[model samples]
Target: MTTYDYLIIGHGIAGATLAHELRRRGRTVLVLDTYQTDSASNVAAGLMNPVAGKRFALAWRADDFLTAAATFYRELEQRFGQQFFFETPILKLFSSVAEQNTLLARSADHPWQNFVEELAPSLPPAPGVRQDFGGVRIRRGGYLAVRELLVALAAEGLEQGWLRRETFDWNQLVVGPASASYAGDVHARRVVCCEGAAAVHNPYFDWLPLTPNQGEVIDVECSGLADTQVLNKGAYVLPLGAARFRVGATYRWPPFAEGTTEEARAELSQRLASMTDQPFVVLAQRAGVRPAVRDRKPLLGVHPATPVMSILNGFGSKGVMLAPLLAGHFADVLEGHAELWPEVNILRYHALYVAARKEGGFSS
Candidate 1:
């Protein structure tokens, strides 16, 4: 019969960040989660790239988010005695002259130019590599050890009696105007749902346009590839220390299935084989649903109809880079210190949902 100020469901990146923030603010927080079943955080390559690999466009709010996320992880490491963040560069191999030109144009006027290093001319491509332009170096880009960080957070929550190891049953929830009660004993002033793609099943906030995608990846052990930097030619190859690399990511829509298939393994092996002729051993493969949106921004803020509920999911592929800053913003809203960002707030979805409902559009 323990009551808390905040109850978080899920222990993925978003939920872990929220719990960390609330506990840091001296609030009693509870987390209910069932971890390690193709959880997006566990399967994530944890790569943070400043420039999108396809179009070379700068990531959303790269400057603000990058600095804040780095500081957040560093501070967390110092506080918890665990190293969660690594500062490594991303070497993006250019495909065509047109792409190289676009990169040049962006480098001149882009705000994140300082983080981009010119490396197209001198660095020769490795054997069996071919490209129109050499490549560009992304400064201060790296991966977060998401699994380790979650373990540390869960340990902290356990020490404080704020973590429950079980799946949450929706039928046990009793909502009120100012508070929420879960399973009769767990009472909280508010509840924030960070259940990744599962948020679409939430009764109050399900109407938002959540375009979830299934991404599959392969884990391989390659002997010679350096473990310092994330390499990008066509598919990304993230070095996971000690000759282990994670290669992956095929994006598919709707028909959501969280199991890796033989076809996926073949596709990923094809791409990895194309990257290098080096012998690699396929160790494992996994697939998980990323909580993406049509507009490619995070979905954050309070529920429109139910004042006691809120959500902090929909980080999509950039959960590590996006969650730390957005979690602080959510904390600000809960503390009544600031308003939520309009571009990312769920209220915009509510507005659109209302309009669509009036126009006879299908809404939840």
Candidate 2:
């Protein structure tokens, strides 16, 4: 049996970053996971856009999160010897006059004005990208090489003997007051579950309001499109160098089956057409479920009754932007150095667990 300070379940963005933070703090860790092609982290485009939605409302704590994320990825680059994060301007194209007016109104303000560079009606923002609507150049925007980073992290973990490529059986997880034991061969002081959408089936944390959505992205090879910037209106086109781009995505809710579908392919093809009429070839299509939440917040904290088991999930599409900083914050809380932020802490939903217990319809 090998006992560690922590056992992290999942190698997605959240688990990888958290494990790295803990190990950097000199804690021994073992990551238990098997690669899944359709997992969000594997198929993610890793887009980071602060100027979001039709109303141009900024993402929550956008400034703080953006700064921290940049620093974090740069630090990862130093540690991993690869460039994972790329900083580039995003060209936000306007679809209609009303949308353009809203952008103008926002740009007229002090901070909003500082974040954008005026563009003359989408005048060929990038090669092969549309030029009809004129767009605003957003300063704080970029993409993380999500899939590549995970592969690298997995390789590193495997080389270091801290990552086991296998499926985790729930029946084998035993939680104690001060520690956890798994599969008869692993013991840890605490177990942190970062299992993405799979948490819906977790007996210990299923009370959470996790709203998983099916998202799809398509890869294409366009000879003319440049890799210097990202383009967004209804959908996004992220350049992957060598004239390749990843275009996406379509969000599907419940009653939807998992995996890639023809409908999504057509829908994305149409959206890509709307972005440009340039020549391109579809290289591949991917489908994954994003672990979203009703309140659009990341879930963090330990099980109420089972103190040795905790979770960090529901990051949805913002995992790249939110995980790095939040992992550090949560690490601080786990180490008793700081209190968990009220907005994202799982303690807010303890009442739901209590209510479920009273109803006698829940799992451990």
Candidate 3:
């Protein structure tokens, strides 16, 4: 039989980050992951941006999130000796003068103004690209190598005797008010679930209003495109290491099929064709359901009824940016060193679920 001070489930960015934070605090932790065939972290582009979309509003808690995230990743990279983050400028191509004006006007007053800069007026026209709409450069943003980081952390955890590469069985789990345990020949003081969309099946924390959106990205081997830049035009064309680029992220409110759909492939093909002049080969296609909430915020904290069981998910598309900060906060809360952020605390969602249950409507 084996015992640990803490147990973490799932190997996604959220789980990996949390495990690292706990380990740094010198806690004996065990990470249990089933290595699900379909995983969000494995397919994530790991883009960390302070702003997104047409509105160009600042990402929620951009300052704190970015600072904490960058610092966390830098420290981890130094410790692990791997490149996890790269500060790349994102070129957001505008569609019309009105859009560019909207961004420029907001840039003056927005906190992320420094991130927005004007590109060269003599920028050459790109074939199959909308050049009439000038582009806005967003500095201090870039992508994380999500898969590599997760793998490295998993290996580190294993070497430290803190990783279990197996499926966690609910039947062997005991949930209590102050602590959780697994009774199947192994024991742990506390168990935290980081299972992405599968958290829906969790008996305790499933009440949160989660709108899972499915998205897909395609890998293309293209040359002559700028390096270390994410070109955003509706969908982003990200420069993957080597000469390959990732073009995608088609959002489907409710996923139609379990895997990549033909429609999505065709849609991506069309979008990529319009993004560059060079003939690109579609190397691969992948999909994952985002665990986004209605308000587009993450859900973190202890379970209201089952305090023994806790969850750290709902990172959605911002997992890479939010994980480092939220994971540290969560560790503090668990260790009785600090409190949870109200914005991300699951209490509000639990309240909404209670109200909805009384009204005979689904919580989400």
Candidate 4:
């Protein structure tokens, strides 16, 4: 039996990146995942923005995340011999005068100045884009071919003999004070759960504030649309080719339904229409659940009672930007070289874990 140094569950962005970092450090690792179709990482458009939302507020640690992501993804592309990261400016078309003012205030003279380019005379008419109110072009933004990256990572992991393509069976998992094992055969010194949105159902860590949000995106073929930049309104139009674009992302909360919905399709089409009157044809639609947290920060750290178990999830839609830096931090913590950042550390939710345990959610 191989006693791996670390066992990782789920091969989504969080797991793959962390595994890559660990392996780079010469650690023996094993990763188990089925790579489910509904996994958010597969469907996500992989948009990375420095300043977002109606308020045009800067993201937390925006500079650090973008810098790390640029370096990390480029490294992965070179190592895997494939291109997955696309660097381009995101043109944010304003919807209202208030939003235009917000952009000016955020970019004119703020720490966010470097990440934004305020439009001159604002709202210049593009070939096929509609910008009623002025907009701003964000400099530190891009897209990642998320599914392709995973495929490349999977191939690399297989060739390296560290990956198993199978669903993890918790029923067969046994954890001790210092280690964890699966089916009484697979063994590792520590287990890190990177199970994406499914972590909400994980009995060991369900006590934490891991909220799931379902998002949907559609691929379309619209001729004549500019292919150099990503256009944004309420939704975004990401250019994939000369005549191909990926528009998406309808947010559905609560029930967190599986698969796609007709309502989502209509909503997406309407969003596209709002941005442009282009007569594009929908090629495909994909939906996945994001492992988001109520606090809008990631979840990381070891379990309260079981030091053998740890979690690295809750990235939500910002997975592309957040995964790189956070993974490096946790990997450093794992190697005893550093500690987990307080804001993202799962220990902050230890009280909730204990409360849920007392309420009979799971045995300690």
Candidate 5:
């Protein structure tokens, strides 16, 4: 049997980042993934904005997360000889006078002053864009080519013979006091589940309040759209080169299945139209389910009852920025160097797990 220090399930941002971090720390790791093309990480536009929401408030832990994410992606670029990370400014268009005023006021505030700046007139104008009230230029913002990055990471893992392309069966997992064996052939000191939205069906973690959300995005060929900066208002218009842009996304709760819908396409197209007058042709549409949680925080750390089994999921839409920082912390916890953050610890749902067990069973 092949032995490893860690066995990770899923190859999305969470699993890929964690595997990279653990391997960097000299751990023997094995990654198993079915590599579903419609996974959230595959379809995500990878926008890493420091400030978000219609109110222009800074994202949670924006400073720390942005700094770590930037450094991590840059290092990955150097290592892989690829250009997937783009550090571009985000042009946050104002939909109303109140929104613009709120942004201006916040720009002058303490922490916001560091990242928020008034849109400079010197910047090239976005033709056909609706900017009657103008917009603020947010610094320390950018995007990663999530799909490309995942492909590169998976290639490296495969080349090293540490990544397998297959579905991981939960019933095949045998958890011991200090180790777990998968398929009765692969043995690992610990198993980390990063199965994304699929974790809702995981018997070990189904009780953790994972609310899978289906999100859709469309690829459009807009000839006149500017690629200088990411355009955002109600929806985002991310330039993907070749006169193409990725416009997304519509969130649907209780997603029955993973597939694109006409409703989502219409929603995205309408949002895109509201943001710009540039005529565009929709080239393709894609859909995936994000591993969202009830509290909107990432779920991490070892399982309460099974010490050998752990999790690093529930990143929702912010995986691009959250993955690197959280992966480092999780690796530290796995190495006995730190503890899981209280808010994100799976132990927070211990009572729910017990209740489910008592009630005969729970449905994911």
Candidate 6:
């Protein structure tokens, strides 16, 4: 039998970040992942925007999240000798005068001062882009090459004998008073599930309001577009070097399948057309499901009945920015150095789970 301090399921952003944080604290950890092709982290554009939406409101804890994420990704780049993070500005094109007024108001506020900057008229027009109502430049924003980063991290973990490629079987998980055993071969003090949308089928956590949202992105090659910064209007167009760009995405509830759809392609095409008049060749289209929660916050902490089992999931679309900070907090809680935030704690749904179990909605 093999033993470790913790066993993590799923190697998406959440699992990978938490595993790294735990290992940095000198804990013995093993990560298991099936490498699902349609996982959100694998397909996400990895955009980190502090100010989002037409309202130009600041994201929750924007400053803290951005600062922590910058430090975390930079350290990983140095450790792995890979360049995956880029600090690029996001040019948010205004669609109407109301939108411009919103930006002006936010720029004058204290909190938004550092992140929102007004572009000067001296700057040249973005090639192949339309700026009918002008635009504002957003600072401290960029995209992460998520797939590349995961591949590098997985290679490192495998080299260290701490990561395995395999499907996790929940039926084989046996939780005891102080520890848990999996597959009758691996034992650990704790088992943390980062299984994304797959958590809907997990017996211990099926009671959670995990709504899977399907999204799609299109990869296109534009020959003459010169702008490298991210462009956003109704949708985002992210440059991926060498005249290639990634544009996405559409959110639909109850994602029926894991494949791309024509409806999504047309939606993305319309959004791309809305941003620019440039001609481009469509290289590819991809789709994935994001695990969103009813409360629109992350779900973290231990199971009420099983102290040896825990979870870190439901980050939705902001996983790229939120994972690093929340993972560190989870590590601290695991080490008994801190506690889980009330809003994100899984204990908030204990009553719901209990009720479901009593009604035979779930099996023990």
**Using Cα atoms with residue i matched to residue i, what is each candidate's TM-score against the true structure?**
0.92, 0.96, 0.91, 0.97, 0.95, 0.96
Candidate 4 minimal-lDDT segment of 10 residues: 117-126
- Model 5 off-target regions past 4 Å? 119-124, 360-364
Q: Between prediction 2 and prediction 5, which has the larger TM-score?
A: 2
lDDT of each: 0.82, 0.87, 0.79, 0.88, 0.88, 0.88
TM-score of model number 2: 0.96
| Tens digits of per-residue lDDT for model 3, 252-344 | 886357888788878987876655666778899998877888888888887665566788999988899999989999999999899888988
Candidate 2 structure quality by residue, lDDT tens digits, 174-237: 8888998999999999999999999888888888999789999999988877678888878899
Error of 2 at 86 (Å): 1.0
Which portions of model 6 miss their true places by more than 4 Å?
119-124
What local lDDT score does residue 104 receive in model 3, on the 0 to 100 scale?
60
Better of 3 and 4 by TM-score: 4
Q: Write the per-residue lDDT of candidate 6 for residues 1-364, one digit (tens) a residue.
A: 8999999999999999999999999999999999887899998999999988766768889989989999999999999888888889998888877776666565655476688766432235878887877887889999999999999999998998899999998788888989989998899999999989888988878888888998899999987765579998888889999899999878889836659998888988888877787888889999999999998899998987778888999999899899999999999998899989998998898888889888887645
Residue clash pairs of candidate 2: 121-134, 122-134, 122-135
For 215-313, candidate 1 gives per-residue lDDT tens digits of 898999888666666777767888788888888788879885659888888888887776666788999999888899888888888876677888898
Q: Name every residue pair that clashes in candidate 4.
A: none
Among these predictions, the greatest TM-score belongs to 4
Cα RMSD for predicted model 5: 2.1
Cα RMSDs, all models: 2.6, 1.6, 2.9, 1.4, 2.1, 1.7
Model 3: residues with Cα > 4 Å off, grouped in runs: 119-130, 353-364
